[model samples]
Structures are given as C-alpha cells and as structure tokens.
Target: MKALLLAGGLGTRLRPLTENLPKPMAPVGNRPWLEHLLLHLKREGIDEFVIAVKHYPEIIQNHLGDGSRFGVQIEYAIEQSLLGTAGAIKNAESLLSDRFLVVNADIIHEVSILPLVEYHIQHKGLVTIGLTEVEDPSHYGVVQQTDNGEIVRFVEKPKQDEAPSRRINAGIYVMEKEALQWIPKNKAVSIEKETFPLLIEKNVGVFGKIINGYWMDMGTNERYRKVHWDLLDRKCSFPLKEKEQGNGIWVGKDVQIGSGVLFLPPVLIGDQVHIGERSVIGPYAVIGDGCTIGKHVRCSETILWDDCKVHDSAQLSNCIFGYDLELGASHILYQAVMNRTAGVLQG
Candidate 1:
C-alpha cells in the first residue's frame, strides 16, 4: 500500500530549531523525526511513500534520497506555495493510489495501520480518520462519532465548553482517491475546515477508528522534549534500542568512558563518543556520534548532536547542543536549546 506523508507545514511554532531544519527533520533519538515515522510505516508493510513537502524540501530529499537505503520507494510532491493540509494531499493526488494512508509528519505514534486499513476496506468509507482521546481537546481537531464508529462531525480546535468529544484527529487517515475531487486544486485548503465538512454535508461516508496506542504531536519545544523523555522513561512502547550495560544506559559503538565518570540511567551514548575523567552524564541525556567531553564536564537531561566538543568544567542541564557545537571551558547552560550558528555559545 502507498502512504502520503503530509510534511508541508512550515513549522512556525518550533522556531529557531526549525529555522534551518524543517520540523519533520527535528532530531529524536539521534535521528530525524520523520525518519522514525517512515520506518514505522515501513515495518507495517507499506513500501511506497509520497511525501507532500514545501518548506525546506531539499533537506528531506538530501537525507532520504528516494528512500532506497531505508528499503522503501519515496516520491516527493513539492508545493511551490503554501498549501494547507487537504490542499497538500490534493497536490500529491496523482501519485496516490486508489486508496492510500495519510499521516502527519510531526506526530510520534505507535498505532498499527493494518487494522485501520482493514476496517476502511471492509466499510468502503470515503475516509477513516484515526482518533485518539486526549485529556485536553481544546487544542486539537475534535470529532463526534456514533457508538458504531461513524464520524458525525469534526470541530477544529473547539473551545473547552463547545467540545463535543475528547476523541481528536490523530492526523492519520485512510483516504480514498475519490475524496481528492472534493478539494480544490492549487489552493490552500484544510481538510478539517473544508473537505471533511463538505463530505459530511454531501452525505459521504466518513468514519473514525479509536486507535489505542501512544500518540503525541510534537509541535512545540516542550512536547518535542517530552517525546524524547517519555521514550527514555519507558512511558511508551515505541521501538528503540535497549540498555546493554550499566544503569539502563544505551551506549553505541567505540564509546570511550574515562575513569571516575558518573552516568545515570536512560542515557544513549552514540557511536564514538568520548567522555573525560570525572564527568557526569545522563539522567535522560543523549550524546550523539563522535562527541568529545572534557574532564569534569557535566551533562544532565541534555542532547549533544554529532561531532560536538565540550571543554572542561562545563555544565549543561535541560539543553540541546546542535551538531558540531563547541562549548568553552566552564560554560553553563540550563533550559536552553543551542546550536553553533545560533549565537548562544558562551566563549
């Protein structure tokens, strides 16, 4: 089956981090966020993907490169201008099969697509939206459905008092190609605001599948960090490497740990990482590939991307150090995301 990955959002919420990098490219577990989504779909027996992209499309193309290395065929539908959710799918219409799965790029989820697809096929619905109950429905696209799973209404970001149901759109769907005809071509259109409402008004079949699994829309810095922390804390059952050594720390190949160093659990030390003597790392830290840490440096709840260097006596807590960043001696950071080019580096 083919899947259309809606990756066209400009990511206005995740600023600075999304300045050069697209939101879908945000790092989670030492890999691009979209990579996780793609691999997850790949494991579910979907091989072909059509990625609808607009902002920073080249970066995705450069990294994924036809998706051959990942054992999938990738095709991109680049929108020259901004198109809303439904419009982006409309832009990629020709590439989609008669029926295809659509998923949002920013979500970190573990719901199985096979069951959703099977249900859609059996019912022959125009659209089957994957729904998950959220504690707060005011910020999401809420849906009202019958007890039998037929969707009756969709409220996009309803007020607290006006919300009809806690089941919100999980940003995953099984959509028939015929549904694309309802969306106008070359225009910004929201499926929630335009197409789905029209479908219901026209008496088209639209259903909801209340999927039971981990789901989080990592659209904010807090939620983004929370996704990583949740995975590290074992709050979700997403596939990730397990600890092979002391204290639930997942260390990579050729990692060097100096004497007298301290490491807390749930830390992931990437390939070829070097830590100096008496350094303290982790309690939810991710040291990316080829990083070098100086003596007595401390890192907790931090993420150091590939090839970064930290000088002696440096301390970091609740921070993210981007690729190739260099930390001067005695530098300290708390609750900030820093990259080498962002000018937050302390000399």
Candidate 2:
C-alpha cells in the first residue's frame, strides 16, 4: 500500500536538537529517528511512499534517496509554504493510490497496518485512524468512538478533566481517495480541526482502530531520551546492528576496551569507539561512532553522538552530546545537552 509520510515539521519542542536537523532526523539508537518509522512500515509490506517535506528538505532527500537502501520506493513532495497535516496530504493527492496510509513522521510505533486496512475496508469508511490508549490523554487528540468502532468526535489537546476518552489518535490513518476531494485545493488545513469534523458533518464513515503496542512521539528531548531507555528495557523493539557484547551491552565494529573499564548493561557503543582505563559507562549509555573516551571518565545515562571526544577524568551523567562535541579534561557535566550548532543546556 502507498503511504503518505509527513516529514515536514519545525519541532519547536526539541530546541537545540532540532535547531539544525528536522525533528524526524534526530538521532535515536544510533540511527535517524525517521529510519525507524520507515523500516517499521516497510516490514508491514508498504512499499511505495510519498514523503511530504518542508524544513531541511534536502537532508531527507539525500539520506533516503529513492528509498532503495531501505527496500521501498519513495517519492518526495516539497511544501513551498507551511501547510497543515491535511493540506500536505492534499498536496500529494496525485501520488496517492485510490486508498492509502498516512503517517506522521515524528512518531515511533510498532502496530501493524494490515489489520487497520482490513477494518477500514470492512466498515466502508472514508478514513480509519489508528488509536492507542494512553495513561494521559490530555496532551493528545482524544478520540470518542462508538461501540462499533466508528469515531464520533475528536477533541484536540483537551484538558485532563475535560477529556472524554483515554484513547488518543496515533497519527496513522487509512484514507480513501474520495475523501481528498472534500479538502480544498492548495490551502492550509488541519485534518483534526477541519477535515475530520467536516466528514462527521456530512455523515462520512470515519472509524478508529485501537492498536496495542509501543508508540511515542519523540518531539521533545525528554521523550527522545525515554525512547532509548525504552528500547534497552525491551519495552519497544527496533532493529540495530551492534552486537551484544554481554550483559545487555551492545557494541559495534573495531571497539577498544581498556583495562579496568567498567561496562554496565544496556549500553550501546558504535563503531571505532575507544575507551581508556578505569572509565565507567552505562547502565543506560549510548556512545555513537568514532567516539574517543579518555581515562577515568565516567558516563551514565548519557548519549554521545558520532565522533565525540571526552578528555581524561571527565565525568558525565544524564548528558547528550551532539556530533563532534569535545569535553575538556576533568570536566564534570551533569544533566547537560550540547549540540554542534553551539546550543547548550546545562543543569
């Protein structure tokens, strides 16, 4: 099935991180966050994709060119101006199939799409939104559905006391082409605020499919960090190449471990990493490719991006270092986040 992947959003919530890269491009588990979504969809047999992008469009185009690397055919639609969710899909209407899937690029989930498609077909609905139950529905689009699975209302970001349901929209949908005509041409529109409400008004069949599995929108640093820990904890599953060294510690090619170095489990170290003597890493650390760590350095619950260097005796905890960042000797960084673009947040 053809899937419209929304890849264009200025992730304001993920400041320093998104300051230079798109939200979908943020690094998670040693690869681009969006790669996880693409691979997940591909595993479900969705081969053709229409990626709608705006911010840093070329980065996405260059990285996933033709989608051949990931075993999928990809076509990109660049938005000249800021177009809301439904508007972006409407812009790519020509590339869409008679019936297709729409997914938000910033979300990570493992729910299968096949059943949702079957459900949509069975109900003869114009759209079938994937729904997931969450502990807190106040920050999401609360979905109210009938016992038969037909969506009766959508409340976007309602207050906790005002929420009608704990089930929220998971940002994955199956939409029939006939529904596209209802959306006006070349205009900014929100599917949640405009299209879906209009569909309800016209009595168009719109249903919700509740999916049970891991799902998260990594639009903030806290969420981003939580996802890594989640993957390590086996709360969510995604493919990675690093081999598990032992005790849940995964390492990549050409890694050098020095004497007296302590490795706590659930740590992932990428290729060509060098750790010096008496250094401590993990419990939940992710060290990226080409990193150089000095003697007596301590890292815990931290993420070091590619080629980062930590000087001797430096201590780090709950830190995130962007690509090529260098920590000075004996530096003590705690609850800090730094990016290559010179954005720094220190606790």
Candidate 3:
C-alpha cells in the first residue's frame, strides 16, 4: 500500500539541532531519521510513498532523491506555505487515489500496517486511526471509542481527572479516498483539531483501533535522545545495521578503539570513529560516523552526529553534538546540545 508521510512541520521543539536541517534530515544512528522511517515502512510492504514536505524541503528532497537507493518510489508534494496536518494531506490528494496510509513524520514505530488496514476494511469506516496507550493523556488528544471500535469523540488534552481514556492518537491513519471530500481546500486544517471532529459531527464513518507496537514521538530533544536509548536497548524490533559484539557494544565498520580506553556496555560507535587512550565512554553513548575523540575524554549518555571532534581531556555527559562540530581541549560539557551553523558553532 502507498503511504502519505506528513513531514512539513517547523520542528519548533527540536530547535538548534533542526535550525539548519529539517527534522526529517536529522541523524538517527548512522542514517537520516526519515530514511529510518522509510526503510521500516518498506519492510511492511509499502513501496510507494507521497512525502508531503514544507520546512527545508530541499534538504529532504536532496537526501532521498526519488528513494531509489532505499528501494522505494517517492513522490514529493511541496507545500508553499504552512499547512496543518489535514491540510498537508489535502495538498497531496492528487497522489492518493485509493485507500492509503497517512503518517505523521514525527513518530517512529514498528506498527503492523497490514493489520491496521485490514481492521479499517473490516469495519467499513472511511478512516481508522491507530491509537496507543500512554501514561499521561493530558498532553495528547484522547480518543473515545465504543466497544466495537467505532470512534465516538476526541478530547484535546483533557485534564487528568476528566480524561476518558489513556489511549491517544498514534499519528497513523488508514483513510479511504472518499474521506478527502470532507477536508476543504486552500486552507490550514488540523486532523485532530478540526477534520476528525467534523467527521464525527457529520456522522461520517470514523473509527479507532488500539494498536500494539513500540511507538515514540521524537518531536522534542528529550524524546530524540530517548529514541536512541530505546533502540540500543532492543526495546523495539526495528532493524539496525550495526554489528553487535555481544557485550552491549554495537559498532559500525572501521571503528578504532585506542588502547586503555574503558567502555561501559550499551555503547554504539559508528564508522571511522576513534576513541583515544584512557577515555571512558558510554553506558549510553553514541559516537556518530567520522567522529574523533582525544585521549582521556569522558563521554556518558552523549550522542554525537557525523564528523564531530572532541579534543583532549574533554568531558561530555548528556550532550548532543550536531554535524561537523568540535569541542576544544579540556572542555567540560553536560546536558547541552550543540550544533554547527554557517561555519560557526552553536550551543
């Protein structure tokens, strides 16, 4: 089945890291975040995709470039202006001529798409939204569904005391072509704030299904770091290309570890990485491709993107380094996110 990926948001919550790059282009492990999502969906039998893009669309277009390298066919729908969730889909209506999967690019998951499609077909609903349970429904749009999977209503961030259910919109939807009729043209519209509620009020066929899978919204800096930890811990079933050393160390090719360097397990070192002598790395550290670390450097719970350099005696804990950035010698970095921009450094 074809999938419509909504990837147009400004990535406000993940700023600095995404200031120069689009969120979809941000590095996740050794690959771009969008590439990871695309490959995962490809495994689920989706070979055709319509990627709705807006903010920094050129970066995404340049990276994916028709998706042939990833064994998928991609069609880009570039929105000239900011469009809300539903409006983005509306912008790509021409490409979706049948029942297609709609996904918000902010989420990464291993949801079984076929099962959700099947569920949508069995109920004969115009749209079936995937729902997942979270501890706090106060921050998300909660859905009320009947015992038989029919969606009754939606509550946008209800107070904890009045929350109808813990299940919130999973940002995955299976929509029929006919459902496009309800969304008006040439305007911004939110799927949660306007479209779905309108469908319910009009007595249209809208349903919800509780889905089981590993799901995370990597929309914030905290959540972005957490996704790495979750993946490294094997909490999800998504495929990774790293070689596991059976001692909690996963490394890519040509990774060099200097003598006397101490490592705590659950450490991931990417291609062409160098760890200098006497450096203590990880318990939860990810060294991105082409990174160089000097002697006696200490890194704990740190994630560095490609080509970053840490000079001698540097200490990094709970820090995120963006592409091609460098830390001077003897620098002590903690709980900070740094990204390079226009040949300058930002922290």
* TM-score against native, each model: 0.95, 0.96, 0.96
How would you encode candidate 3's per-residue C-alpha lDDT over 1-347 as one tens digit per residue?
68999999888888888888888778777688788889989988999999999998999999999999999999998899988999999999999858999999878787888889999989997999999999999999998888888888998899998999999999999999888889988789998989999988887789988887889999988999999898788787566667888687888889888999998988888889988999999899999999999999999999999999888888898998889987877767777887787343324
Residue 144, candidate 3: C-alpha displacement in angstroms: 1.1
Local accuracy of candidate 2 as per-residue lDDT tens digits, 20-116: 7788888778888778888988888888999999999999999999999989999998899878999999999999999999999989788888999
**Global lDDT of each candidate:** 0.86, 0.88, 0.87
lDDT of 3 at 52: 95
Residue pairs whose backbone atoms clash in candidate 2: none
Candidate 2 weakest lDDT stretch, 10 residues: 338-347
Q: What is the lDDT of candidate 2?
A: 0.88
The global Cα lDDT (0 to 1) of model 3 is 0.87
Task: Kindly list the per-residue Cα lDDT of model 1 for residues 33-146, writing each as its tens digit.
Answer: 889889988988999999998989999999999999999999999999998999999999999999999999888888789889998988888999998998889988899888
Write the number of the candidate with greater TM-score, choosing between 1 and 2: 2
Candidate 2, residue 85: lDDT: 95
Worst 10 residues of 3 by lDDT: 338-347
